[model samples]
Target chain A: MSELLKIENLHVSVGDKELLHGINLTVEKGKVHVIMGVNGAGKSTLMHAIMGNPAYKITKGRILFEGQDITELSVDKRAKLGIFLSFQSPVAVAGITMENFIRTTKTTVSGQQQKVFAFKKLLKERMNNLSMDASYAERYLNDGFSGGERKKSEILQLRLLEPKLALLDETDSGLDVDAVRIVSKNISEYHNENNSILLITHLNQILQLIKPDVVHILIDGQIVREGGAELADEVEQNGFDAYRLAVKGDGNDEA
Target chain B: MKEIAINRLPVLTYRYLKTNDTKILFSAPQVSAAADFSDKTYVTVGAEFPENFEGASSETLAAALAGEKYTITIPSGMQAKLTIEIKLENQHADYAGAYHFLLQKGAKLELVWKLSGTEAAQGSYLASYYELEDAAELKISKLQADLAEATLYDQRFFKLGKAAKADVASAELGGKQVIVHSRGALNGDEAALTERTVYTGTGKQHLDLFYHIDHWGKKTVSLIDGKGALAGEAKKIFRSTLDFHRGCAGSEGEEGDYAIQLSPKAKNISLPLLLCTEDNVAGNHASSAGQVSEEDVYYLMSRGFSWEEARRIIVESLMRPIVDSLETSLQEETLEEIRRKLDAKGE
Candidate 1:
C-alpha cells in the first residue's frame, strides 16, 4: 500500500486561540482510519484543517497529499484535487435544487458537462439506493430536511463525488440505528482499493458495520495511541477517561 | 426638457436622503405611436381614456406625459388573454403610453406586456390601470428588457371590487435607470391583491421601486413581495407600504423586500412600512439588504465551485423563483438578460 495522505506536526488555530496542537498522521490508499476522542479533543479542527477550511488556520507543519504540499490551497482548489469533507452540520441553501447542485458540482470536478436526462437517471438511481424520496431531487438543497435526511444527503454526496480522501466529521452523530446502518453501508461501498477514509466518531454503532484498518485514540489534539481495529472496541469499553487522566498527569508533571 | 418629481413616497422622510421622491428629466417624444398587438373584438386600439382613470403616478408629472392609450374590456362571465408588445426605435428618443383594462363581474383575464427597445439611449414612460368589478379575476405579467443606455418609467394602478382578486408579477431586467411605481386599492369585501416584483441590476444601473397597497374593505388581504440582486456598482432603493383603513376590520396585510448585493461597491436600501387605523386589522412588514452569506459561499466552494462560480449560482438561485414564474418565452428572455448582466454563460 502507498501513502495517500500525510500530516506532519500540524498546528491549527482559530482566531487568537490555538485549537490543534502539533499533530502527525498518515493514511495509506485503500485503508480506513478511525479517530476516537472526547468532546473538544480537536477532532473536528483536524478534519477542517485537512480540508482547508479558512476558519482553521495552519500555523505550523505541512499537509502532503500523495507527497505534494497542499498546506496553502484554498478549499475549492483542494476539493478539485480530490479532498472531500462530510460536514457534521451541512448548511441549508434555498433556491437551488438538489439535482442541479449535484450536477453542477459534478461538472466542475469532472470538467465535463452532464447530459440532463442521463444525469437525472443517475441521480434517481443513486437516490433510490439511499432510500431517499424521489421528490427530494426537486427540493431545495438541504432546506427543510430532517436530521436523518441531512445525514443521508451528505452520504449521497460522498458516493457521488468519489474523492480520493474523504474526511468525515462525525457523520454518524445525529443518525438513528437504521440510518447509521444505511450510511455505513454507503460509506463501505464508496471505499475501494484506490480511495481512503479518515472518519471521526464517538459511537461504536458505525464502527461495528465498517471495520477500520487503524484506530487512533486522540487526546488533547495528539494521537496518544494507535493500534488495530480492537483499539476502537477498547476505547468504546473503557471510554476516554483513562487517556484524559494520563494527559492530566503528564501536564501536572510539566507544571 | 424639464424636470419633474415622480414616484413620491406617501409619507415624508429626511430631505437629504432623497428617498422621499425621485426627479427625472422629461420631454414628450415626437414619435408617438400605438403598440403592436393582435387586435381582438374586446380590445380597442386607440380608445379614449376613461374619465375616472387614475394611475399610480397620477399625482406626479407622469400623468401629464401619458400618450397613445389602449383599452381592453372583458365581458361578464368571460375569459380572455392578451399580449401587447411595445418597441422603441431611435437613439435619444422618448415614448409614452397608457393601457386601460376593465374586467366585468365574474370575468377573468390574463395579460402580458413586453417592452423592448432598438436604440441604446432612449426614454419610455408607461402607465397601466386595472379595474375589476365584483368577483372578477386578473393576472398581469410584465417583462421589461430595454437597452442598457435607456431609461424606463413604469407605473401601475389597481382598483378591485367586492370578492375580486388580482395577482401581478413583474420582471425588470434591463435599462440603465428604471423607476417603478405601483398602487392598489381593495375597496370591496373579501378582495385580495398580491404583487411580486423581481429585478437584477448590473454595471452602473439604478433602480427605484415603490409599491403601496390600501385595504379599505372588510376582510381584505394584500401582499407585496419584492426580491432582487445587485451587482457591479448598481444601486437600488425599494419602498413598500401597506395601509389598513379604519373601516377595514378583519383585514390583513404583509409587505417585505429582500435584496442580495453581489459587489463590494453595490448599494441596497429597503424601507417597508405598515400603517393600520383599525384595531382589528393585522399588518406586518419586513426588509432585508445584505451581501450573500459567507458560509453559503464557502459551502458551495467546498463542492468544487470557484468563488465566482459559487457567487453566480447563489445569485441565480435567489432570483430563480420569480424568473420561473414567468411564461416560457419570457422566462428564457429574462434569464438571458440576467446572464448577460452577470457576464455568465448559459448553463
Candidate 2:
C-alpha cells in the first residue's frame, strides 16, 4: 500500500512546554489506524497538529500529505486539500445554521458554491441515516446539541465531506451504548477504498465495529507498540497496564 | 427655534453636535399620507396627534419647524399591518414628522418602520404615539441604518388598555448621532409589554437610548431587553426604567442590558433602574459589557471563515434576538446591513 500521510519526528508545543516529543507515524491508503491512549497521552495534540490548529505549535519535523509537504499550510488550505479533523468539542456558531455551515464549508473545499436545493437533499438523506431530526438542519451549529447529538453532528460532517484523510479525534469518546453504535456505524461508513482514516479513541466499542487495519498504543507522545487489528482486541480485554508501567520509567512529557 | 427644552436628560444630550436652524419640510413624500389601508387598514399617517406629550424640545421643535403630522384609527375587531419605509430623500435636507394610531377593542396592528439616511448630511426628528383599546394587540418593528454624517431623534409613546398586549422592537445599524426615547403606560389590568432593541456604534458616533415603562394597572408585565456593540471611539449610553405603581400588585418587570465592547477606547454606560411602589411584585435588572472572544474567532477560522466573517457571526448572534422580531420580509435586509457594518472592521 502507498503512504497517504507521513509524519517525521513531529514535535508540537502549546506555550513554554512541549507536548509531543519526537513523534513519528504514518497512515496508508484505505487503512484505519487507531491510536489507543490514556488521558494526557498527546493523542489530541497529534490530531490537532495535523489539522493545523493554530493553538498547537509545530516546532520541528515535516508532515507530507499525498506526497506533498503541508507542514506550513493554513487550516483552510489543509481542509481544501481534503484533510478534515473532527474536533472533540465542536464550537457552537450562533445564527449560522448547521446546514449553512456544512454547505458553505463544502463549497469552500470544493471551490464551488453548492446549490441550496441539492445540498438540502443530500443533508436530509445524511440526517435520516443518522436518525437526526430534520429540524436540526435549521438550528444553530451545535449551539445546544446534546452530547450524543454533537457526536452525531461530527459523523454527519465526516459522511458528507468524505475527505481524503480524516482525523477522528475521539468522535466516539462521549457516547452511550446506542450513541456509540450509531457513531461507529457512521465512522465505518466514512471509510472507503480511496481514502484513509486516523481514529483516536480509548473506547473499544468503536474498534469492535471498524475492525482497524492497524493499531498503535500512543504513550506520552510516542508510539509504544504497533500491531494488526488483534492489538485492539488485546488492549480491550486487558487495559494498557503493561505499557502504563513501562512508560512510567520512560519519563515522557505529561500531556 | 423657540426653545429645545423637553427630553433634556443630561447624559443623553449631545450639546456639542448642534442641529440646523430647525427648518420644517413644507411637504414630504405624500405617499405616506395616502397608504391603502383596506387590507392592513394599510396603516399609515392619517391626522390624529396631540399637540404634546409635555412636548420635548425635539417634539416642539419639529412641530414648529418641519412639521408633518398624521393620525389613523382602526375600528373594533379590525386587523392592520402598517409597513412604512421612511427614506430621507433630501440628502442634505432636514426632516421632522409625527404620527398617531388608535386601535379599538380587540383590534390588532403590526407596524414595520424602515428609516434610512442618504449620502448627504441630514437630520431628522419623528414622534409616534399609539393607543390600544381593551384586548387590543400592537407590534412595532423599526430598522434604522446608513445614518453616517446624520442625526436622528426618534420618540415613541404608547398607552395600553385592559389586557392589551404590545411588542415593540428596533434595530439601529449605522448613524453618526442617534437619540431614541420611548415611554409607554399600561393603564389596564393584565396589560403586557415587551421591548427588544439592538444598536451598533462605530467611528466617532454617539448613540443614546432612553426608555420608561410604567405599570398603572394591576398584574401588568413589562420587559426591556437592550443589546448593543461599540467599536472605534464610539460611545453608547442606555437608560431604562421600569416603574410599578402602588396599585399594580402581582406585577413583574425585568430589564437587561448586554453590550459587546470591541475597542478599549469605546465607552459603554448602562443605567437600568426599577421603581416599585408595590411589595408583591417581582423585579430584576442586569447589565454587562464584555470583549469579543478571540477563541470564537479561532474556531470559526478553523471552519474556513475569515476574521471579519467570524466577528460578524458573533455580533449577529448578539442581535439575533431582536432581529428575529422584525417582519419576515425585513429580517434578511436588516441582517445584511448588520453584516456590512461589522465587515467595515468594527469589532
Candidate 3:
C-alpha cells in the first residue's frame, strides 16, 4: 500500500519543556495504526504537533503528507488539505448551533454552497444513525453535552468530514461500554479503502472492535516497538512496565 | 477624558459636555386626546407635564426651546405600545425633543422608538421623563441606525412608585458620535428598574453611555446590563452607577458590561460604580473586553472555516440574543439587517 503520513525525527516542546524527542513514524494509506502508551507519553502532544496546534512547537523534523512537505501550513490550511484531528476534550463554544457550524464547515471544505434544507436532511439522517437526539442540531455545539454525547459528536464529525487521514486523540476516553461500541462502529465505518487513521488510545475495548493493522508501543516520546496487532494484546496482558524499563535501556527493542 | 477606559484606551477626542441645543416643545397636542401614536408620517402627541415641572434644568431648557413635543398616557389598569419615528432635516444644528409619559396604577406600556431621517453631520438630542404609578410596568425598546454622519445625545429620567418596574432596552448601531445619559430614582417601597443596551459600530464611530439608579425605598432593586461590539476604528464607553440610600436597606443592584473589540484599532471602556450608605445591601460590577482567541479560531478552522469566517461566527454570536428579542415582523427585518452587517465585516 502507498504511504499516507510520515513523520521524520519529530521533536516538539510545550512551553519551555520538551515533550516529544526525535520521534518518527509512518502510516500506510487505508490502514489503521494504533499507538499505546502510558500517561505523559506525549501521544496527545504528537497528535497536536502533527495537526499544527500552536501550543505545541515543533523544534525539529518535518511532516510529509502524501509525499509532500506540510510543516509550515497553518491549522486551517492543513484541515483544508484533509488532515483532521479529533480533540480529546473538545471545547464547548457557546451560542454556535451544531447545524450552523457543521454546515459552514462542509461548505468550506467542499467548496460548494450548501442548501440548508438538503443539509438538514443529511444531518438528521446521520444523527439518527448515531442514535443522537434530533434536538442536538439546534443546540449549541458541545455546550452542556455529556461526556458520551461529546464523544458521539466527535465521531459524527469524523463520519461527515471524510478526511484522507484522521488523528483521533482518546476517542474512546470517558465512554461506557455501550458508548465505546457505538463510537468504534462509527470509526470503523469512517476508515475505508481510501483513508487512514492514527488512533491514540490506551483501552483495549475499542481495539477489539476496530482491529489495527499495526500497533506501536510509544514510550517516552519514541516508538520503542513496532509490530503486528498482537503487540497490543501483549501490552494489555503484560502492561507497559517492560516498555518503561526498555526506554531506560534495560529491555530489548522489538522492531 | 472618558468616564471610563478599558484596556488602556487613549483619551477621547470629544469632550463630555453637560449641555446640548435640542429644544423640546411644551405645548399640548392640538389633536384630540385618546388618539393612538401609531402611524409613521403623523405625530400628534405632546408634552403632558406641567409648565413648571421642577426637575432637571437641562430638561426644562430643552423643553422651553423645543418646537414640537409628544405625550401619551396609559390610564389605570391599561396598556399601550407607542412607536415614534424621528426625522431630522437640520444642518449642523442640535435636534432635541421631550417625550412625556405617565402610567397610572397597575398600567403597563412598551414604547418602541425608531430614529431615522437625515444622516447629516449634526447633533441630535432626546430627553424623556417617565412617571410610573403603583405596580405599573414600562418597557422601552429603542432602535437607531443609518446616521453615521451625525452625533447623538439622549437623556432620560424615571421616577418609580411603590412596586413599579421599568425595563429600558436600546440598540444603538449608528452615528459617528453618540452619547446617552439616563438617571432614575425609586421613591416608593420595593420599586425596581432594569436598563439594558446593545451597541454595534464600525468605521470611526464613537458611542458614550451613562446610567445611574438611586434607591430611596426599602428592598428596592436595580440592574444595568451593557453589550457592545466594535470593528474598524470605532470606540465605545459605558458608565453606570448604583447608589443606595440609608433608608434603602435590603436593596440589591448589579451592573455588567461585555464588549467585543474585533480589531486592534477598536476601543471599549466600561466603568461601573456602586455606592452604599445602607448596611444591608448587595451590589457588584463586572466588565470585560477582548478579541476572539486563536484557540477558538483554530477550533472553527479545524472544521474548514478561514480565520476571517471564524471571527465572524464569534462576532455574530454576540448579536444573536439581541435579534431574538424583537417582535416577529421586526425580528425578520432585523435579522436581514444583521446578516448584511455581518457580511460587511471590518477589523
Candidate 4:
C-alpha cells in the first residue's frame, strides 16, 4: 500500500532541550497507527511536529505528505493538504458560534463559500453521529463546554473535516468511559471514511474500540519499539516497564 | 426663566442634495422655528427636508431638518418601523451638515440611518427626545457607515411613564468619529429600559459612547451592554452609568462588556459607574479593555492561523456579541461592510 505520511529521523526542540529526538515513522493509507508511552515520552511532540505547530522546532527531520516534502509548510497549509490535529486542550473562542467556525474552516480549506443551509445540514449530521445536541451548534465554540463536550466537539470537527491524515492527541486521556466509547466510535467512523489515522494517546483503552494496524512505543523522545495491534494489549496489561527496559539497553537511537 | 445658552454653528460642506424630493429643500426659518419647542407635538421624516441645502443651518433642528414636518399619531398602543437614510444628491459641501430628530408621547419608533462621504471632522447629529405616556414602548436603532470623513453624535433621551419600556441601540461600523449618548429615565412604576451600543473602528477613528439609566420608578429594571473593538490607531471611549434616584425602589441593573485592542497604539477606556440612593435598588458594572491576549494569539496561531490571522479572529470574536445581535436578514450585509472596512486596513 502507498504511504500517506512519512517522518524521517525527526528531531524537534523547544528552547534548549529536545522534546522529540530522532524519530522515524510512516503511516500508510487506510491504516491506524497508535503511539503509547509515559507522561513525557514525546508522544504529543511527534504529533505537533507532524502538524507543523510553530512552537515545536523541527531541527533535524523531514516530513513527507503524499510523497512531497512538507517540512516548511504552515499549519494552515498542512491542514489544507488534508492534515488535522485534535488539540489536547481546546481553547474557547467567545462570540464565534460552532456552526460559523466549522463553516469557516470548510470554506477556507476549499477556497469556496458554502451555503449556510448545506453546511448546517452537514453539521447536524456530524453532531448527531458524535451524540452532540443540535443546540451546541448555535453556542460559541468550546465556550463553557464540559470536558466530554469539548472532546465530542473535536470529534465532530474531525468527522466534518474528513482530513486525509488525523493526529488524535490524547483525545481519550481525560475523558470518562462513556465519552471514551463515543470518541473512539467517532474516530473509527472517520478512519473508515478518511485516508489514514495517527492516534497519539497514553491510554490503550481507546484502541480497543478503534483497532490500530500498528502500535509504536515512544520513550525518551524516540520510537523504541514497533509492532502490530498486539503491542497495544501488552502495554495495556503490563505497562511500559518491559519497553522502557529494552529501550534503555538500546542506548536511545533517534529512530 | 433664564434663556439656555445655545450655540448655533452652521458649517455646511456636503454638496449632495435631493432635488426631486420637495421635503429636502432648505426651509431654514421654518425648520428652525419648529425646533423651538416649549410645549407642542411634531413628527418629521425625509422628503420634508429643505431643498436649498446651502441655506440650511447645521446647528439647530430648524436648519438641519429645514423646518420639515410630518404628523405621526400612534393610538394608545402601536408599533412602527422608521427608516432614516442620510442620502446625498450632489458631491458638494453646502448640504453636508449635521441633522436632528425628536419624538413625542404614545409613539413607538424604530429607526435605521446610513451615513457616508463625510469629510474630515464632518458628520451629523440626531438629537432625539422621547416622551412616553402610560405603557408606551419605543425602540431607536441607528446603522452608520460609508464615511468619506464623518463623525456622528447620535444622542437619544427617553422619559418613561408607568409600565413603559424602551430599547435604544446603535451599531456604528464605518465612521471616522462617532459619539453616541443614550439616556433613559424610568419615572413611573414598572418602567423598563435597555441601551446597547457596538462600535467597530479602524484607521484614525474615535468612538465615544455615553449611556445613563435613571431609575426613578419602583420595581423598574435596566440593562446596559457595551462592546467595541479598535484596530490601527483608532480609539474608543465607553462611559456607562446607572443611577438610582432617592424615591425609586426595587430597581436592578447589570452589565455585559468586552473590548479587544488589536494595535499597539489602539486605546480603549471603559468607565462603568453605578450610583444607588434607594436602599432596595441593585446596580453593578464590569468591564475589560485590552488587546487580544498573547496567550490567545499563541493558541490560535498554534492551531494553524498566522499571528495576524489569529489577531483578526480575536478582534472578530470580541465584536461577535454585537454582530450576532443584528436581524438575520441584515447579517450578511453588515458582515460584508465590516469585512470591507476592516480588511482594507489589514488588521
Which candidate ranks first by TM-score, i.e. highest? Answer: 1
TM-score of each: 0.92, 0.86, 0.81, 0.79
Worst 10 residues of 1 chain A by lDDT: A246-255
lDDT values, one for every candidate: 0.83, 0.79, 0.77, 0.70
DockQ of every candidate structure? 0.68, 0.33, 0.56, 0.33
Interface RMSD for all numbered candidates? 1.1, 2.1, 1.6, 2.7
lDDT of 1 by residue, B147-192 (tens): 6677787877789999999988889888888888888999999999
**Per-prediction CA RMSD (Å):** 3.1, 5.1, 6.1, 8.8
What is the per-residue lDDT of model 3 for residues B1-347, given as tens digits with 9 covering 90 to 100? 11322111112233453121212223211111121246423234577654433222344335323634666578899877767666544442345666677889999887787665456535555677788999999988777776767666676778999999998877777676776777889888899998888777688887777788889999999999887677889877787888888999889999988888877898877777788889999998999899877777777788777777777777666666665554344555555554555467453
**Residue B12 in model 4: shift from native, Å?**
36
Highest-DockQ candidate: 1
Ranking by TM-score: 1, 2, 3, 4
Better of 1 and 3 by lDDT: 1
User: Candidate 1, after superposition: displacement of residue B179 in Å?
Assistant: 0.9
Q: Residue B314 CA error for candidate 4 (Å)? A: 4.1
Clashing pairs in 1: none
What is candidate 1's lDDT per residue for A1-255, written digit by digit as tens? 999999999999999888887889999999999999999999989988998888899999999999989999988988888988898889877778998889888888777898999989888988888889999999999989998888889888888888999999899998988889989999999999999999999999999988899998888887777888988988878787778777777433211
Order the candidates by lDDT, highest first: 1, 2, 3, 4
In Å, residue B36's CA in model 4 sits off its true spot by 20
